[model samples]
Target: MQIREATAADWPAIWPFFHRIVAAGETFTFPTGLGEEEGRDWWLLAEPDRTVVAVDGAGTVLGTAKMNRNHMGNAAHIASASYMVDPTHTGQGVGRSLCEYSLEWARGAGYRAMQFNAVVATNSNAVRLYESLGFEVVGTLPEGFHHPVHGYVGLHVMYRLL
Candidate 1:
């Protein structure tokens, strides 16, 4: 697989899995009824914020990630990122590759650290992946996320020093 910066045209391929993941209400905090234009606006960040896609040899998009400052001004040194992998492509290292690429980008961009503010507690795969990648759970908000099936679940704040 190859990882590259995403273009506006990439949205057509990204939206399908992005829509499914968001609508599932399992991991991401995105609202269920997010529209196409809104999703594009949210995912296809501009300028210093970066968005990238992981594609197979045939050029099929397998996953995507967006990285940016966790906060503005004085807090800008801290970076944050989000990832989405095609459900059909899970376990094929798509998510891992995107995450690794994002970390490299963040470090190269001079970020002091990276933080994930709202990782769903029940998403063990993601939690494990983050831990394996050197992130630690700094805190958890009890019953912070309302999972569709599991009801209220914790949201973990994870951090890693660059």
Candidate 2:
């Protein structure tokens, strides 16, 4: 597998998985019923921010990630990122590769740290992956996210120094 910068053309390949993940309401807090255009605009960020896709040898997109500043102005030194892997591609290290790529990008771009603003507590795989990558749970807002099946759950604020 390889990680590379995403282009507008990649949106079509990304949209199916992105839409399904967001609509699942099990992990991400993204609004359900979001249209393709809006989702594309939200994920494919502009300059100074980055969007990437992970692909196999055959060039099939397996996952994607977007990295950008966690805050503006005085707090701009921090970076944040989000990831989505194709369900058929999970357990293949796609998410981890995207995350590591984002970290490298953040460090090269001079970010002091990376912070994840809203990590669903019930997403153990993600929580574990972030922890393995050196992120720590700084705080958790009780009953912050309303999981479709788990009902209300905590939203963890995860952070790590670059």
Candidate 3:
């Protein structure tokens, strides 16, 4: 698999899985009914920030990530990234590849650290991946997220130095 900057053309391939993930309301906080145009606007970030895709040998998009500053001005030294792997491609390391790519991108972009502000505590796969990658749970807002099936769950604030 290869990870590369996402182009506008990739949106079409991204939307199907993007829609499924968001609609599932299991991890991401994006509204369940978000539309394609709005999804593109939210995911396809501009320069100084980045959006990327993980693709297979046949050029099938397997996952995507968007990386940017966690906050502006004085807090700009910290970076943040969000990832979504195609459900069909899970367990194939697509998410890990995108995440590793984002970490390198953040380091190369001069970020001093990276923080994930609202990781759903119920998403064990993600929490484990982050922990394996050196991120630690700095805090958890009790019952911060409303998982579709899990009801209210904690939202973890995870962080790591670059």
Candidate 4:
């Protein structure tokens, strides 16, 4: 697979899986039933912020990630990112590749650290992947996320120094 910066045209390809993941309410905190345009605006970030897609040899988008400053001004040295993989493409290392790429990008961009503010604890695969990549759980908000089937569950704040 190859990783590359995403273009506006890529949003159409990304939206199906993004919509599915967010609507499932299993991992992300995004509101279910998010509209297409709004979702596009949220994911296709601009300028110094970066968004990328992982694609197969055929150029089919397999997953995506967006990285940006965790806060503005004085806190800009810190970075944050989000990832989404096509459910059909899970277990294929697409998410791992996207995450590794994001980390490289952040370090190259001079970020001091990367933080994930709202990782759902029950998403063990992602939590494990992040941990394996050097991220640590800095804190957890008890019953912070309302999983569709699991009721309220903890949300982890994960961090890694670049």
lDDT tens digits by residue: candidate 3, 32-64: 999999999999999989999999999999999
**Which residue pairs in candidate 1 have backbone atoms (N, alpha carbon, C) closer than 3 angstroms, thus clashing?**
none
Where model 3 places Cα greater than 4 Å from the true spot, the runs are none
What local distance difference test score does each model get?
A: 0.96, 0.97, 0.96, 0.96
lDDT of 2 by residue, 1-162 (tens): 999999999999999999999999898888988889999999999989999999999999999999999999999999999999999999999999999999999999999999999999999999999999999999999999999999999999999999
Single out the weakest 10-residue window by summed lDDT for candidate 4: 26-35
Q: Cα deviation of 72 in candidate 3 (Å)?
A: 1.1
Candidate 2: regions farther than 4 A off: none
Tell me the TM-score of each prediction against the true structure. 0.99, 0.99, 0.99, 0.98
Estimate, for each residue in 1-162, the C-alpha lDDT of model 4 and write its tens digit.
Answer: 999999999999999999999999999888898999999999999979999999999999999999999988999999999999999999999999999999999999999999999999999999999999999999999999999899999999999999
Measured on C-alpha atoms, candidate 1 has an lDDT of 0.96
Candidate 2, overall lDDT?
Answer: 0.97
